[model samples]
Target: MKNQVSTIYKQAERFAEITKTAIITGNISRAKKCLALAEQLLITGSNETKIAISNVYLFSVSSFMELRHCSISNLFPKSLKAEYIKQINTSGV
Candidate 1:
């Protein structure tokens, strides 16, 4: 179980990086696809993994917010935004 979670977490990280690159390259569709995949993987993760991934997402959101002057909620779907908020609150992050 532990190894599986770790593997899933790593794959999600890779997808997140891909999403970042896609966004940097102005590939909005690709970025959205990768982001969705990353979110799906995150949903299946353990609570600890969810918290870790939330941190990553928070960092990405902050970077994008700084660059684009956009709201954090605009970066995620409604469900994902809620989940991330829950993780952040539960983790005290």
Candidate 2:
């Protein structure tokens, strides 16, 4: 069981990294989907996994805030604003 939990967390971390990359590249849908998968894995793990999930969400929220307020126009798309909100609202991570 411990090994299985560890593996799940490992997978979650990998997925989180991928999600972060998608966010950086302005792929909101992909990022949101990946993040949802990560959260699912974390949800099935122990309490520590929940804490790790919180950190992941914090990182994502901070990244979104930075991208949304970026001075350059292309860094963040106006159309993504609604999607971002939807993602955050649904993200229990």
Name the top TM-score candidate: 1
Global local distance difference test of model 1: 0.62
Could you tell me which residue pairs clash in candidate 1? Answer: none
Please report, in order, the local distance difference test score of every candidate based on alpha carbons.
Answer: 0.62, 0.54
Model 1 lDDT tens row, 1-93: 654535544654555666777777877788667657557646886886666566665455445645776455655765567766776678686
Task: lDDT for model 2, please.
Answer: 0.54
lDDT of 2 by residue, 5-88 (tens): 355446545555676678779887786676565456445757776555555543454465566674322332332343444555
Return the TM-score for each candidate structure: 0.57, 0.44
* Location of the lowest summed lDDT over 10 successive residues in candidate 2: 71-80
Q: Which parts of model 2 have CA positions greater than 4 angstroms off?
A: 1-14, 70-93
Error of 2 at 68 (Å): 3.7
